[model samples]
Target: MNRILRVKEISELLGLSKSTIWRMRRDGLFPAPLKIGPRAVGWRESDVTDWIKSRDRLQ
Candidate 1:
């Protein structure tokens, strides 16, 4: 099954600050999170992995 990752996990995985992730999301540079709860959000692990792979191709 596909996993969902919280902001902390994504931040640590990408070595980016949570604010930076939020900015990226705002700018459409990152995938938008799914609303997991009234005050919680998460990203699909596959989406993040695919994003990383795409970044690798660009570099």
Candidate 2:
């Protein structure tokens, strides 16, 4: 089964600040997070992994 990760977890995994991710989402520079609920947002494990790979290719 696929996993989902909250902002804090994603931040830690990426070694980036939560706010930095939030801003990237706002500016449309990163893969947008999923709206899992009315009051909750998260990133799918696949999506996050894909984003990381895409970024890696750019470097």
Candidate 3:
């Protein structure tokens, strides 16, 4: 089963603000978030973790 997380969760996990993540989405510089419904969006936990690890590797 896919463990999904919402924007708020991702923001908290990443220690960043929702607006920052949203802005990155708008700029197409962030991993694409999945839309679970017309009114709901989220990221897979694995995807979020991968992104974090990727960022870590860059440092």
- Scored by CA lDDT, what does every candidate get? 0.97, 0.90, 0.88
TM-score of 3: 0.89
**Reference-based lDDT, residue 5, model 1:** 100
| lDDT for each residue of candidate 3 in 1-59, tens digit (9 for 90 to 100) | 87999999888887889999999989976789888999999999888888888888999
Q: In candidate 1, which residue ranges exceed 4 Å CA deviation?
A: none
Candidate 2's residue-wise lDDT over 7-53, tens digit each? 99998998999999999999987788789999998888999999999
Instruction: Spell out the clash pairs found in candidate 3.
Output: none
Query: Candidate 2: misplaced stretches above 4 Å?
Result: none
Descending-lDDT candidate ranking: 1, 2, 3
Count of clashes in candidate 3? 0
Specify the poorest-scoring 10-residue window by lDDT in model 1: 24-33
Candidate 1 lDDT by residue in tens digits, 1-59: 99999999999999999999999999999998999999999999999999999999999
lDDT of candidate 3?
0.88
Model 1 pairs whose backbones collide: none
By TM-score, rank the candidates, best first.
1, 2, 3
